[model samples]
Target: MIWKTIKVNFHRLGSPPTFYRLAEVLAPWLWGGFAVCAAIGLYQALYVVPPDYQQSDSFRILYIHVPSAWQAMAGYVVMTILAVIALVWRIRTVEIMAMAGAPIGAAFTFICLATGSLWGRPMWGTWWAWDARLTSMLVLLFIYLGIMGLYAAFEDRRKGARVACILILVGIVNIPIIHFSVEWWTTLHQGATIRLFSGESTLHESMMPPLVWMTIAVKLMFGAALLDRARNDLLDQDRRKGWVQSRLGETA
Candidate 1:
């Protein structure tokens, strides 16, 4: 039954008409959620939240920095999963998702590092540090770039996807190392942000609400971005197919 279900889905997999219909249903909802959540998050962070005692306004960067870091890693994790699926199933759409995810993850990593540096200058008295966590994150950004480059290198796109997928799986070992380095080694990086195991936050309560809201907004934005990018990838890959042409005609 499972194998039959897989076969059925695989047969319909390249049907751009079906995928485009699904994309149409998702697009509006994704964009709408993004707009509403973004506005509220920004308001909550900027106006409603109080300043941090230690870093004052500088801590406000955490609203952006932390979430960007979280999503950057999250994006890569999704990308890696998609890559594995593509390799195992030889699914073109899955490969496309991995392709789309790399740049988005790279963008998130860039934001995290930039905002982190900005925050560091005010708080740590240094704009740049060679700390384990920071270094590992930097490596993660490079991994994203590497995967994208690998995806583009081979003349055969499928071959490229497979190779890139392997690389992602290998590079993922660094993510756990990055997360635990601060705990294992005495590092400049701070501890957990939303630690449930701990009774209380190291941060002030006034700043927590906006930070939480902003994280939610970031997550929503990432989801919307992923959906749009995946749709674009599907369209490109399916252009020569009958369903895609039919859908194009229907839209026209």
Candidate 2:
């Protein structure tokens, strides 16, 4: 009974109009959470967390570097899942989600690479390295670029979406490589600081709270950005439809 109920609701919300309305309702809350949490996280990260014994203040880069890396990979997984839905179910809204998600994911991946390089300069005494984690992450960024480029190449948007979906599915393999590269091979990068199974983290108590807050803040920010992008894509997709015409008329 519960599964049937969930299936019904999922289909109902899958409709473009319903999803647009839901996005509208969610946008403010997501942005508000992002603002509050980010402010608190920044305060704690800058003032509360003490300097590292080895790296000193340079260690502070993890606050930005860690969250950006996590979010970058997370965004790709989200795009891949939505792409699968679009491909299997032939849902236009999900297709738009997949399309809209790519640029955002790409942006985060770029940030991850940039910040990681900045962190490395002070610690590794170099601007870049062909380390396993870094190389895999660079490949992830190139995949993102390829997806975007492929989608833009076709004048027929539907055909473009189909091809992009296939590319995303293929690129899903790199995500695991990025996550385990530090463990699988020797690298300048450190191992995981936080463990999910055990309540174990390498960070001190003062540092952990800010890191936690920053992670949540980044996720919320991603949600807000994704919804905003999806909403805009829906507008572009449905511009010729009666509902969008009426909505535009009312606003005008």
Candidate 3:
């Protein structure tokens, strides 16, 4: 019964109007959640949590850096799922969503790289290093740019999305590499301080709260951004359709 309900909703979401309406309704809520969570997280990270003995206030950067890095990878994973559904089911809405996610993911990747560099300058004595983790993250950024470029290259957006979906699938390998790079290679980047599966965390309990709050904030932010972009893409793609015309007429 649950599966049937989910199946019904999934099909309904494939309808452009339905998806657009859903995005419109949900995006504002997501953005609100992001704003609230980010405000709390920033407060806790800056004032509530004590500085690290070794790194001092500089380590606070991790509150932003870690979440951005996680969301960058998480956004790609969302795109991958959407891409697979798009390829297999030929769902137009899914294709639009998959394409729309690239820029948001790229933004997070840029933040990750930028913050990492800022954190590294004081710790590693260099602004940049070709370390395994850093190098793989840089590659991830390039992959995101490549996906965006490929999608924009074709005049037919659907055809471009199909080709880019293949690239999205191919890019999945980099996610695992990024996750394990610290373990696999000697990099300046630290290994996981908080382990989910093992239920072991090297980080102090007090420092964990900000990371938790910031991670949720970014996830909410990503969803909000994705839905906003996807809705715009849908409107642009379906501008000639009667439903879109009616929506525009109503809005106007």
Candidate 4:
């Protein structure tokens, strides 16, 4: 029964028309959520939340840096998972999802690195350092770049998707290592104490809620961007199909 349901759902997913319509409906909600959440999160972080006793005013970087880093890590994992599904089941929709994730993930990764540098200058007495955590994140950024390059450079998308899919699988090994590197190895980057309701979280009440809200805002932004890109992608791939012609005709 479960397998039958999976099979049927996948059949619908194989249809570009269905996936395009689904993405169309979702794009608005995703962008709307991002805008609303971001407004609240920023107000809380920038105005309501007090500065850290230790770091003072510079701690404001956390509102941007922490959330971007978290999303960078999250977007990669999501891409890797979609890549794996694309490879295993040959799902066209999954491939599109992986493609949708590349640029957005790369954007977040760059934000993490840039904001980390800004924060590091004041806190760590340097603009940059190649510590284990820093090094791993840099590598992740390059991985995202490679995935985008792989797809764009090819004449045949199927072959390109295969190459990028392989890279995504290879890079996933870095995620766990990146998370634990601060703990397992001697590194300048600090270890995570708070991770989405983890036991180690000790952040104060005022700070915690805003941090979470910021994270949601980033996730929503990613979703909206992904849906927009995915819709364009599906359209490009299915341009010759009848539904697309009908869709265009209806709009006309």
Best by TM-score: 3
Candidate 3 ranges with C-alpha deviation above 4 Å = 1-3
- TM-scores of the candidates in the order shown: 0.89, 0.94, 0.97, 0.93
Looking at model 3, the pairs that clash are none
* Candidate 3 to native Cα RMSD, angstroms: 1.1
The ten-residue window of minimal lDDT in model 4 covers 193-202
Off by over 4 Å in 1: 1-15, 197-199
lDDT of 2 by residue, 1-252 (tens): 999998998998778888888898998899999999999999999898888899889888788888988998999999999999999998877887888878888888888889888988988889899999999999998999999999889888778988999999999999999999999999888888888787687777777988899999999999999999989978987899988888889899
Task: Indicate whether candidate 3 or candidate 4 has the larger TM-score.
Answer: 3
Give me the candidate number with maximum lDDT.
3
Q: What is the lDDT for 52 in model 2?
A: 87
> Which tens-of-lDDT digit does each residue in 180-249 have in candidate 4?
8898889888878586565767667767878889989998998899889988987887788999999999
lDDT of 3 by residue, 12-83 (tens): 999999999999999999999999999999999999999999999999999999999999999999999999
Report the alpha-carbon TM-score of model 1 versus the true structure: 0.89
True-vs-predicted CA distance for residue 234, candidate 4, Å: 1.8
